[model samples]
Target: MTATRAPQGQEETRAGLWARLGDRLIVGGATVGDHGRDGEIVGLHHGDGTPPYDVRWSDTGRVTLVFPGPDARVQHFAPHAGPSAVRQS
Candidate 1:
């Protein structure tokens, strides 16, 4: 078996991934012939990254509200200048 990293960002524990405003969501399987979609969280309806996020798609360049499923995973980005506590396990 091979390992795969989340596209465009790093994959950390789900604890630190509350679907932050600027974080990205990577969905689908990590293998060949996999279809996945990703986008940035622009708006948070619940104020937290719980669900129903407004995402701007990289492929379509459009913003849409999303309720991510179980197949979805989050990829968090680092701040401009700060120590990141998002460690990979």
Candidate 2:
């Protein structure tokens, strides 16, 4: 994984990322009152805690820039390869 710095003028445009880098994002059922997609955060476009993530989607194996919505949830991948916490928004 590479360290990412915030983009020019992007810090003022939005808040922050829904999940941290290397975190797993589950959509659809995890989406605020919705259900549907799942992915792993492979890159960050801003600060470590910032938004507009580069997600490598699980189903498609494609990387996409994502601004996670209310239905998003994060599963912190542990050193042991297990989920440490499952936090929902």
**In candidate 2, residue 10 scores what lDDT?**
41
lDDT tens readout by residue for model 1, 1-89: 89866664454455533766777877775677878788777788886457888888877989998878788886766643111354567
What TM-score does model 2 achieve against the real structure? 0.56
Model 1 bad stretches (over 4 Å): 1-17, 29-32, 79-89
Worst ten in a row by lDDT for model 2: 9-18
Best by TM-score: 1
Deviation in Å, model 2, residue 36 alpha carbon: 1.2
lDDT score at residue 53, model 2, on the 0-100 scale: 78
Q: Which stretches of candidate 2 lie over 4 Å from their true place?
A: 1-18, 29-35, 79-89
**lDDT for each candidate structure:** 0.71, 0.67
Q: What is the number of backbone collisions in each predicted candidate, taken in the order shown?
A: 0, 10
Pairs of residues at least 3 apart in sequence or in different chains that clash in candidate 2: 17-50, 17-51, 28-34, 28-35, 28-36, 29-35, 30-71, 31-71, 32-70, 32-71
lDDT for 40 (candidate 1): 75
Candidate 1 clash pair list: none
